[model samples]
Target chain A: MTDEGPLTPRVTGTVRIVGAGLLGASVGHALRARGADVVLEDASPSQLRLAIDYGAGRAATADDAPTLIVVAVPPDVVADVVERELRAFPDAVVTDVASVKLEPLRELVERGVNLTHYIGSHPLAGRERGGAISARADLFIGRPWVVCRDGKTPASDLALVEALALDLGATPIEMTPEDHDRSVALVSHVPQLVASLLAGQFADAPDGSLRLAGQGVRDTTRIAASAPELWVQILAANAAPVVDILDALSQDLAAVADALRAPEAVGARREVADTIRRGNEGVERLPGKHGQNRRFASLVVMVDDTAGQLGRLFGDLGALAVNVEDFRLEHSPGAPFGLAEIAVAPAVLRDAITGLEERGWKIASTTND
Target chain B: MTDEGPLTPRVTGTVRIVGAGLLGASVGHALRARGADVVLEDASPSQLRLAIDYGAGRAATADDAPTLIVVAVPPDVVADVVERELRAFPDAVVTDVASVKLEPLRELVERGVNLTHYIGSHPLAGRERGGAISARADLFIGRPWVVCRDGKTPASDLALVEALALDLGATPIEMTPEDHDRSVALVSHVPQLVASLLAGQFADAPDGSLRLAGQGVRDTTRIAASAPELWVQILAANAAPVVDILDALSQDLAAVADALRAPEAVGARREVADTIRRGNEGVERLPGKHGQNRRFASLVVMVDDTAGQLGRLFGDLGALAVNVEDFRLEHSPGAPFGLAEIAVAPAVLRDAITGLEERGWKIASTTND
Candidate 1:
């Protein structure tokens, strides 16, 4: 089981994945694809056998000792299964892929298990779907694989977890368990609740009101389709941070509500405007293309319905040695008029705008608004 | 004079759209597409010529009289423009396509303009781009066109406006000007603020934080890239209602936040859970598939790496006469598993689930989640 220079790396010892569910099977598929020996374990023999039959892993007997153990199960059962697996494999580096990190990390430590080999990890990739048979080798590719490195995590444990993440074609992001939970609470948990609440409005609306819904309502409530049980666990675990953000949001909403009741109050309108303005400020701070947190350049062009006019406009921009980031088109009926909005980098904004204007294009100016 | 048959209606003159901007052009386009005679007027000769050239209308001369006049201009200028257009065309039934209604309506009435020929309408449709060239005839199709029929609006004026909306292929939604503003504040204005605030957080995020973003961040902040000035005007105009919604949200957020800061505090966690649970309840209320407020049935099936297993599974379901509304696949790492989430009509859920399980497929229980 060895290799030298110019030879392929020897197949590593099997990495045992308990549960053989979505996360567990994904790990096996990824590891197996990378020439690592993978072993799958599941209480459901049918599920386990399917994983083996699919070449996700070799069938693991009770006596098999693997190099690593990845615990992938429901959040409530993660602690119990992780502890059992740790006991089953005293030497392997054990990690659990759970959404909430700190609670599980603390629970394992409190249980007085061997902490040196345990590393907490969460790969932030998921779909509305669930379970082992859904596992894909490339599922984690290009996604962030968060590795929680704490005092209890040994150097070998960190290295092995990092290696595992790398092997699965994931980017290893080092974060504290607490930080991970807080970040996710703000970005994921709170948003999900917001989306759900917004969508829920339709449930109580009269039939007539529901029929009036357009694309805006649809887009705002898209994430409401998430699994309720899974989301409940996520929200519960990240309760504190999510509540903090919501509180701030609540204060903003309260101010807005007051303004609506009596708009003539001088400062009332400003107060409401301020909250919306703050929202505006907050939204602009989000990252853009390929993770660049830069302002988008908007180009407004007026066109007609000559077939291929849009394609020609886009083609012309491409020929001008300018990169078109993103564009949206607006057409007015009977007017045979079209407005095309194009997003570009900030550095190129002025040049692109001026260039388009020079080409006989009518660019909408924000200053005029 | 126009000829008319028993089946063919009497001659109706053009619906004159003033300003020939994005909104006006869109109105023109929609009307023209629906076989309505349209003519547009703009103070700027270049814009007026452009509107005519773009086929928004056959050139509208100052001497021309129309059956309807649509005033489409900026919010601040709406009242003055509507008044001027009313004075200009005494015989035409008039409507101003403005976002904020009460202010403009009050301003026009106070000026002692002829009230019998005028109504206020707002078609809720737009794109990021603007101006006459951006107009598309189909812009208002299937969208809610609110007719603000106040006590002063003549019955004839209201009827003509509703007829115009029908010709433009828009769903006529009747509401008072005040109610329209308030409703929009909750649905449209406040959401813009929320999206903006979320995006603003990334405005100064550290490089590392920026790199860690995923699809969630992208989606939540998509609307943040809107026109700043246009939003400013909208917020300023409807500050009262937006403030009201924001204030209400703030109160809820504060209660949740207090719960988070003291997780061990007895009722704190419960309150947070309750709020989240309410959010869950709310999200489910949203209309699903073709305007029905029914929960779609979901079946989660475990899958493996067998070639064409998914294709065959879908085929098998099809063969079983199951109509799958929607489906998504997610792979679980380490588990060598894949989970497929399939949506169907509620009545078909149990049957589909049983069929899949009977075929040796391990389907997770829906109730468990």
Candidate 2:
């Protein structure tokens, strides 16, 4: 996600960021580019300096009375830092960008902290690694930045967070703290655990078995490579919701395994089929590029596995005025050619094939489904 | 995989193929293109006719004498079809392409069907849907063809199957029936089950949760869309081995769930960290595009979401002689630009970045790793 519109300032006033890690520095960078004043602080002096050197923002000064405060810290220390920030800047509207919403909010509430100016928000954006060095100005652009509001939250307070989201080119989605926690549990937390669990299966697998691995296992386990230290905190902080989803997943897994173990038993195969069909339906629910996705028709064309061969094909598509909705390159082991699977709107599929054929391209699949 | 080298047929004399499903018709198509005489048969007359009309092969006749027969029936009836084919052409070296090998081999042995001539093989190749309508002549190209052998099997009989694999542009790897079934169980069967189970969780999930779904969930569940009817038979045939792996996975899942449920417990976070680390190691074992893959350095460049922008980038790369090893297009919702994450060799990354920058392309990620 990148900021594409005119780079004019939208957010006003001096903003103080309490951490200078990936998320913190990214927020500073985005706001700084919008011509707003950003003051950065961090427990690590080197980190704060590194972000300043990178032109994300200036170092914090004691005399600076910030109008806004963004607390971007690790999940374990989030509530502690948010509590300190609220007390330090009583009049400033405070927001924290932590993965989980309810735990920190609940912690702040139990501690009897005045959270009238505090808002819990999460921007669903990250890279594989995190650091001030890895921060980007456009990291949150075009991503969903969830803004959590409670009954006590003022309309003016919510507007400030929304403006920050929009200034970074992120879509601001309104959700309650409880709903936000549960939603992320289902979407992010549980999926991380599942991927890690599935990938662990391969650790002990024979090399021969691994040699046979295909795109399926690779895709299912790709996210398992995220840092364990970071995930341990996220999972622990959001334990209840994550556990709820994991328990449900465990039950489904057990039933399917039991059915496979006794295939001849009545309705055993039926149970397995239903579970798989449920997965098919589940995947269809994901929103596509434009909206709730209507699958685009795909065509697999063969391209010579050289530098310029793909360029020739894509250049031809550009010439044909065919907008490729999605595309993936499939390189076969020890093969001279690679398959380019391009998805397009069905209306243009026939013309795309016709045009490519006219250009002497070899179409390997005419399945059209 | 395309037949890039030559059009010469390696296997001599008339070849008979039983079953006109995807694999059967594809074999016919590849063999016919090599100027080899092929006779096709299926239990259903209409199916056989469709294969012939598609130019896969001519229909079988009673007078036809075959030197080799390929049994490409479903796993459930593999032994029956192989037994029939063996009786019809006793002198011919026969092979059957079935997903599970041990069961069919044991069945054929139990029924006293064959003492010689039959070879059990499986080509690690398939599309989302099956049928002659989806068959391609190059379907077997660049894929692994697992050939199972026994002490009693003759060298000449094994040679025939290997030759067929080579002719179809596949790499033949010799494996025992036990090894083949167990290997496929680890890489293919268990993975399919995990994907199905994970996907099933989303079937009842809230739309708000699914809207927050990202690429990790999308990749992990993509294979959940496979045909459940076919998987039921395959999973049933390999029940014992699949259940063994699933049970192991269940234990891991339970341990992590228990740990997450009570984060304050001793060794709680350790248990979660270990599972995730194991997955990290497991995914690393997967082979890359090149032999035992060394990761290619990647650069994420922003492109306009409209048509032809990618063509320009690739064309520039081609001109600069920077071979793009791999690429994926990242489209954002309601954003004017997309990101092209291109993987190239580390040696070329510096030059590639410089050249692209000179060409006025905005490189989003400077993190080389």
**Number of the top TM-score candidate:** 2
Per-model TM against the reference: 0.73, 0.98
Clashing pairs in 2: none
Task: Please tell me the interface RMSD, in Å, for model 1.
Answer: 10.4
lDDT of 2 by residue, B128-189 (tens): 87888888998888888999878888998888889899998888989888888888888889
lDDT of each: 0.67, 0.86
List the DockQ of the predictions in order: 0.15, 0.69
Q: Give the CA lDDT, 0 to 100, for residue A355 in model 2.
A: 97
Instruction: Name the best candidate (by DockQ).
Output: 2
lDDT of 1 at A67: 81
Residue-level lDDT tens digits of model 1 in B77-152: 8889888878888888888888888877778778887767778888888776787877776566546788987676
- Report model 2's TM-score to 2 decimal places: 0.98
DockQ of 2: 0.69
lDDT of 1 at A315: 52
